[model samples]
Target: MGNTLKSVYDAKDNLKDYHVRAALQEDKGKGTTLMSWGLQDFTEKGDHYISVISGLVVRYGKGNSQIDETYIVKLSAPQVTKALRDMVAQGNKKEILFYRELLPAMNSELKKVGLNPLLTPQCLYANQDSENSVLILRDLCSRNFRKFPGKSCLDISHTRLILQELARFHSSSLLLKAAQGPQFVAKYDFLDKEWYNVTEDAIAFFITLFDGNIENGVAILKVLEGDKRTIRWLQTIKHNVYKILEEMMKERHSLHHCVARGLSGYDEYGNPIEAILLDFQIVRRASLVTDLHLLLNISVSGTDRKNNLENFLQLYYSSFKQVFDAAGLQVPFQFHELFQEYENKIMFGTLWALAVIPMIVSGGEPSEWASSHHRAASEEATGKQRESIDSKISSKHGELRARFLPIFDELIDQGIIH
Candidate 1:
């Protein structure tokens, strides 16, 4: 394993083969050689607050013909807190494990069953160094894959592609486990831990952040002139958040994967045709239902989620079952059981609305949660007021209100919160 980026590339025969082929297109037998390579920043400010991204651009040529290729390098941000930097390092290492070990093994199982491999960018290079960890990957953006816009609600077509991708990822785990027994996944034991290792210090931080969001939600509800009953229900939900979160994070189901965030490709008419899930930093072995709740509650618009959640579940299950059917294996659970699981997980949805939606609607960078004010707030016990939190929601009350009103209405209508 090479530590330097250039050494990694130089060691890759296939990469050289690719450049050699491209260079040879100009002249059938002319000699080809690598010319030069350089590095450049790859992401804009706020695109990724926890990690730094850059491109390693390589130029290779043969006799008047040249090709430039770029690979992305992701490293932990040096400027963040030690706690966050540690989490980032853990996530980067986990992702390296996903691409370098997990995905390849999972894809091999899928290949054995004659299914197409799960869609993911290729890992060109990876190192798991605790502080200076890095990954060099084939740049998905070069292939027209783009991050799904975070602020807007995703429509059904976009949502459909995402669910399909999720099904494939989850089913891959199932097929591999079935083929090799449950002990197979036990090797990657880190997937079974909670995403955040909740130490005593971390517990206080998580609860305070949870409370800050709960308070922000209460303010958003009041600003919307929300019904008193609904406001009270949100307050009650606040109290039970940590307990419910603990429950939700438990490993109740065997086939779990990362929370799927869309990195979509569009056709000429500008409609979504493909989705590739990204960000395996928090991959866990919890119920797949939580993935559903997280995506639908946070990523999809409240109206879209309300209108199509059942349809979305059916679509996901069918895609999931189709993989098993094609592989000549039994699906672990029936659709009715899946539906029940979704119903049982609505509390997760409510929690997402309270704790995660503000950041989405307020359009605040996730790094803001690390600000001095919020950090102070996170240290306090639950129920303490954080003016910074209130100001954030107050500044964006209209967007926050619009986003939450329908979500809360749907939750209340289903009798999940009240």
Candidate 2:
């Protein structure tokens, strides 16, 4: 075990103590001893922060009658820069609150509607302090739950499963808001401004990096540079994006409001099991379209999205309606209305793509990439990073152009760009 693992295991906190006892209780053994442990850093590429996942093998009984059991532990990155640390701290706060408060309330609502609770992994222990956070969750892998390949896009079937689950997740919020009113909603409102912090930075990055690639890239840059109206709109959006998100959250009828998991497996019929939602670090009340755009953009391929976008949106709305009807709630919008909202809100996906697609293509660690921008005052370093990122984008040019050009074209057609 490393220093971080040693500290976590030796900590005297109630949460850690409870987890050790709970693990033993689940084994149904009289006594348990830590046999051995292994830690793996499973943080993805381009992740600005680190997540250390550990597996502990425990032994019960002695000699020939021993049984071994495993438990999973999650801990914050032991090392990170100050900027990254602050961002991680913010995300940690949201995730801890989700597990501690929001999830239980949502589960209660699900039960009220005679539905199974949300399908999150069972958390054995959760703790967050000023500088560090930890969560001990049941190892889903032990139950044969796997993850979808990160580099690939979801096919139609998997996409449907994800959308269905997302609809259910969003419905929980609707049910909660309807039953408990704004006060209940208010409790989870700590970081509605989360997106504001990223939007300007992302837009700046997009403009700086994407100026010469796409057909209309230069034109869009010109507008952003010279058009007072466009600049003002950007400023307005920066100032008020959180307020817009809050309003979207408050809306009852739209599937366009609101918001992942990796464990994958096959069911009795041999179909792939639905992926569970994980990571509530950035969860917020928002337009149903927020989640929809994210899913379509990130998970579905460009060609697939172009071909099946409307069908998927319709499918999502239908699923959303089914949940609302089952819960004895009214569906608020017609399919056409929802489709229009999707078109209007599709820019969210474009904005996200501006930041993420580059990273996806670059395949570079975020900390290294981010260091360049952090020192943006140095034109020499910034130019090198730009060239490196540009090369990566060129490598994946065909796929990205297919994925993003249509979105840009649509925006231009809609007069979102001049």
Candidate 3:
């Protein structure tokens, strides 16, 4: 092998111990002799930028036959800046902590209540090395898990499955807190801060990023000839963005769940039958509607969201209530209360759409927003960054308009803005 290829192979070999340990866990008490293993890049372009993801396949012999097991491994990306690397490392640390400690404890509570534990990728092995963190998880692809094919927005079938899973996840938190008391949940309060850590050094970068997103969103609005009043409302949100962000991030509710950053899984007919939530990097104590707002606005199509939002809410509530009822516990909030809270939290949805929809429609890479060292340094650099963002928005102008106009009109119809 060439020097670079040899180094990569050497690194994969070094991870053999973790692969062996994961194999033992999968094999249960049955002794299996390890035969060989291989590693391959597992992530698609634009799927992630923070970490290098690989598939680790290990072969084991049992009698005259052999079986192969696969694991999804994550390692910190080497090409990014130290600040970005540190940020990803922190996220990995939290995910490891969540899977190893908090999730099992919560699952124990679920067991007592006779509800199946929330389905997530099983962590086979993990470490939180500041620079070279590694996380090994059972490959969900073996179970037919995959992201929505292509850049298609989630349809009603897909949204239904996600809502069901999200409801169970949220309800589990409520049950756990009730059984173990707030003190149990309080032990992990540090998670709330880690979700979007804005270190003093990176504050200027985030400010620029946030401001740029809002500007692009407004630009899209004007391009679409969006309501004049709605434009004024968004401008107002931009002016008071910090306070609004703070309020949204505050611990406003008692029940907090493991809100997934994304989900993947599907059945044979190209329809979504099951979904497994991925990435527990931020399990915050926030209103359920906050998470609901994010998922609906970002992943689901605006047409689906506008037409079936109420049905979605009701599905979530019924599913949430079903778990409590099965466990002989009362739901803490009623349907009307959830509906009202969801409306009150409309700005959360608006913010998420503004921040994420443009990127999705434009096929923007994470680095464009994340590589902020230059962008935050001076007025000239900031202007260049804005110009870059404008180019991205314009490249997909038609898609952005189609994706956003429904959301903005829905907000207006609800009297949420304007």
In model 2, where do residues sit more than 4 Å from their true spots? 1-35, 40-50, 53-65, 191-261, 268-270
> Candidate 3: which stretches are off by over 4 Å?
1-36, 61-66, 202-204, 222-232, 254-268, 369-371, 377-383, 414-416
* TM-score, ranked from best to worst: 3, 1, 2
- lDDT of each residue in 25-104, candidate 3, tens digit only: 65443566777877776444454544556787777777788887777776655534444555555666777777887778
Could you tell me the lDDT of residue 188 within candidate 2?
A: 62
lDDT of 2 by residue, 282-333 (tens): 7765677778877777667777887898888888888778767878988767
* Model 1, position 156: C-alpha lDDT score: 83
Question: Whole-model lDDT for model 1 versus the true structure?
Answer: 0.66
Q: Each model's TM-score?
A: 0.82, 0.76, 0.85
Candidate lDDT values, in order: 0.66, 0.58, 0.67
Candidate achieving higher lDDT, 2 or 3: 3
lDDT of 2 at 352: 56
Highest-scoring model, lDDT: 3
In model 1, the Cα lDDT at residue 42 comes to 38
Better-scoring candidate (TM-score), 1 or 3? 3
Q: Enumerate residue pairs that collide in model 1.
A: none
Q: Count the backbone clashes (under 3 Å) in each candidate.
A: 0, 12, 0
